[model samples]
Target: MGSVDLIASLNARGPTSGFTDVPDNDESLPDDFQREKAKLFNPLKVGAFNLRHRIVHAALGRSRSAFATESPLAAEYFRQRTTPGSLVISQATSEIVRTSVLNIRKAAENEGRDQNHIKIIASSTTIVAATDEEAFKKRGEYLSYVD
Candidate 1:
């Protein structure tokens, strides 16, 4: 092997006290490109999923459900982006059959008034979202498959 390959192999074995890099012209990227480019920023795969690009969308707290109940407005927003080949990392969804109690409580708390009224309503909603065994089981199964 050449000198560069030899260096890489040494690094991989974890005994190397230093590292080296081969220089190349990076200006070959498109003139319109605005972001810095590097090999570490390249795309990677995790089993059956192959990312088309290096960009990753982080999970968001959408405050809604896939079936459109929590906030129909939030559901509509996610639905609009369901087109194929788009990379959208979504927030953790509620277990199927779950409701919007967390969101309702969050909204009331943020508004900062009517503490007693909101607490009662929030408590009731929390009870409604908490009573599902089957849904939680299904959620666990789904996570297991992904891992």
Candidate 2:
């Protein structure tokens, strides 16, 4: 599906969107994108350091265990996607402002990446665009993706 269709689908089934990215084939995304000629794989700076590609994942409703700890499955799920210079922003249970850090860190280390490269964030705040004009231009597109 196209990007707008995908977002609308997510909004429609937000609460029940259980790890929606699990592919039907259960196969890893091509690890060779950055090696290809596609412009999506071109390196560029996002917020700070340059990324190897333009792809960034915004995950929802993962780390589904109680607020105390993250499941190993969750770590493994993230580890598979943790290529160097890749960016993933995931949210845990909304009530869990923090959770066990070691499992995710260990998973990153096992993937041959520095654990510090991964960042875990939890919030109940609004995210604004770079400018009011930009925000107004795209109003309501990203609101209430999670119930």
Candidate 3:
């Protein structure tokens, strides 16, 4: 019979560590926690706007932009997430008409395409979840630090 090893590992296919190494009465983490608050939670004044929080919700999806025609849905989408003071950017929308924007080759091929028929750019940086938005901005800051 094989002998069993008594040394248990939390992440090694065993139970997780029951508790943190820090004492139950620990206060150090509490004090340090605020220092690490996300910029999304902080307040900032961008131009004429005095954002409630520095958290800028960058371009998301068409839901936050002109819905097919830059409708109120786009404005509502942004309004839903933004505070009175904060700024909410709508999705990166096209500034020009479809007929004028598409190149000759592509335009000729898709000239009769309806607005709804246009493809959504899935690879667009806009449109992110709350967590993703936070992490995305953080990563941007991190990358800039090295540059």
Candidate 4:
């Protein structure tokens, strides 16, 4: 589904909690929210990259790597997040990130798109579990990151 449709489906189920800040009706979609979100989906040129969207995947300090080498999953992670005409800001400290980015570029080329088009980012995520116990457990785990 599209972003708006996906959001609508979630809103239909009622009480979205932390997932959304708005109520469930069309009237509740504030103009500012729509306008701001709409801008992100619009295209823009940043230096040499003509990005398809403003949505970026910024670098995070956290690494899933268990060793000095870039995990195979690292390339897969970028591949999953890759999109045409997007930008990615990787915080990978060394040349290891080069291999991961090249892997993503190769995947894009395989898909018949220009590999140079990608650049990436994230937004807030609320933990929603099947039960209150699971939710609190997740909350505690998330808090551990903060500490």
Worst ten in a row by lDDT for model 1:
120-129
Best by lDDT: 4
The TM-score between candidate 4 and the true structure equals 0.39
What are the clash counts of all predictions, listed in order?
A: 0, 0, 4, 11
Query: What lDDT is reached at residue 99 by model 4?
Result: 75
Q: For candidate 3, write residues 50-140 as lDDT tens digits.
A: 7765545565445334444555655555555554564665443445333344654366457775645555442334534469879788778
Checking candidate 3 for backbone clashes, the offending pairs are 42-54, 51-85, 60-127, 66-70
**What TM-score would you give candidate 2 relative to the actual structure?**
0.38
Could you tell me which residue pairs clash in candidate 2?
none
Candidate order, TM-score descending: 4, 2, 3, 1
Task: Identify the superior model by TM-score, candidate 1 or candidate 4.
Answer: 4
Q: Number of clashes in model 1? A: 0
- Which sequence of candidate numbers ranks them by lDDT, best first? 4, 2, 3, 1
Q: TM-scores across all candidates?
A: 0.28, 0.38, 0.32, 0.39
Model 1, residue pairs in steric clash: none
Q: Model 1, residue 143: what's the lDDT?
A: 58
